[model samples]
Target: MTLLEVEGLRVKIRTEGGEVTIVDGVDYAVEPGQVFGVAGESGSGKTISVLALLRLLPRGATTSGRALYGGRDLLRLSGRALRRVRGRELAMVFQDPLTSLHPMMTIGRQLSEHVRIHEGLSRRAALARASELLAEVRIPDPKRALEAFPHQFSGGMRQRVAIAGALATRPKLLIADEPTTALDVTVQAGILRLLDRLRRESGLSVILITHDLGVMSSIADHVSVFYAGRIVESGPPPELLSAPRHPYTRALLDALPHPEAEGRGELQAIRGLPPSPRNRPPGCAFHPRCAYATEASLEQVPLLRPVGERRLLACHVDPFAPGP
Candidate 1:
């Protein structure tokens, strides 16, 4: 079943020069108990897209879209209506727990407060639930950890707390934006495992956003490749990994470090930086960096259209098309 659907989601921020669009015409859906991955490099509008869709953008930003959750348009929801739905139905765990978590509050206090607000439990019950949540996230000695402050916990522990808080109300959909970005390799694996287990055990849908293709390959059921404020390709993770059809997606995969290429000196990388939002390149934004670009591809933007069963690509040229 579809848990959330976003269509034509556009976001703009008031810049020094004027307003500029950051996310343009993004569309995707999350299904029950599925892990949907949004992958892209930094400045590709991945984070801003999700934040704007959830009405969580900071000041000077605005969003427009039909984000349907449970058949209701989230964009049209009143602040109060949205608040009622946010934590209980759709929760978010941001990239950095240190900044997202309150330093002054004890771990127990933070989690219990969130539990009480969304679940309407008593102070005593909420506190007990908070400890249970800590256990759920596999934190050792949950009760003792609750007595500590945000800064008292290690990076991995703090991220666990953030996950526990998001799962407090058993939200149907959890948006984890770059959740493992700050963790060490080993710890990053553990966090991804926890999220995958939660989805399997609790039937919780998750939208895991990150720049790491390795992480997505391991945990994501389906994946979307975002670039230059648009989706370039989307399909089952296995398919996208084995047979990426878009030039940008191909470049991204080729850029990953290979164990066999150890003696190759410098690792492969995509040339040129992603275009700045304020100074977006004309036509297909990726044409500047693409190896297969042609004269036709430089002057026209491509719509994200279906190219196969459950697969879509937005590009002027098909990498797998029959040769002349």
Candidate 2:
């Protein structure tokens, strides 16, 4: 079942000069117990799309289009109604644990407070639940860690705690933004394993947003490649990873380091920086950096077209098309 659906979603930030579009007409859906990955370079509007769903965008930012969660329109919800949904029905594990964690508060207090608010549990009960959550996320000695401050934990541990907090309420949907970015390889693997286990055990839907295509391939059931505020392609992980139809998606996959190809040559990196939201390209946003772009691509934007079952690509020239 589809637990969350976002259609034609557009987000613009108001500035002194004019409106700068950050998320442009993106569409995606997440089903129960499915991990939908949103992959893109920095400034591709990955975070903004999640923020828009929670109505957490900063001042002067405007969002339009439908965000339906459980058949209710999230965009139309009042602040109070939204608050009731957040942390209980839908929760977010932020990119930075330190930023999300209150420095002055103990880990126990932070976790318990959320439980008390959302679950209306007693302090004692909340603390017990918090301890279980910490252990569930694979933290060592949950009792001792509860009294520790955010600074006391390592980067990986802090992120685990953050994930614990998000799962405290056993939310139906979890949005994890760059959940493993700051961790080492070992820690990243551990975190990913824990997330996979938790999702299976709890049957929780997830939205995993990151720039790492390898991570997405491993964990995501469905994948969406975003470039300059728009989703250029989306499909099941195997299809998208094995035979990416969009140029941008192929570029990302090629950029991944391959130990087998070590002796071949230097690693490939996508040339040029992501375009500024204030000055996006006229037609296809990625044409400025796309090697395959031609004059035809520069003249018109391509809407997502069906390439196969559950696969869509937004590109003028299909990579899978027969050669001349």
Q: What tens-digit string does per-residue lDDT give for candidate 1 at 151-237?
A: 988898899999999889889999999999998989999999999999999999999999999999999999999998999999999
Q: List per-prediction Cα lDDT, in the order shown.
A: 0.90, 0.90
Please list the residue runs of candidate 1 whose C-alpha ends up more than 4 Å from where it truly belongs after superposition.
Answer: 260-266, 322-324
Model 1 deviation from the true structure expressed as Cα RMSD, one decimal place: 1.6
Task: Write out the backbone clash pairs for model 2.
Answer: none
TM-scores, each model vs. reference: 0.96, 0.97
TM-score of candidate 1 to 2 decimals: 0.96
Write candidate 2's Cα lDDT for 1-324 as tens digits: 789999999999999989999999998889999999999999999999999998889999999999999889898898778898988899998887768888889999999997998778999999999999999998999999999999999988999999999989989999999998878889889889988998899898899998998899889999999998999999999988998889888888888888876587676788988899999898888898888888878988888888779998999878565356
lDDT of 2 at 98: 64
Candidate 2 vs. true structure, TM-score: 0.97
Alpha-carbon shift of residue 68 in model 2 (angstroms): 0.6
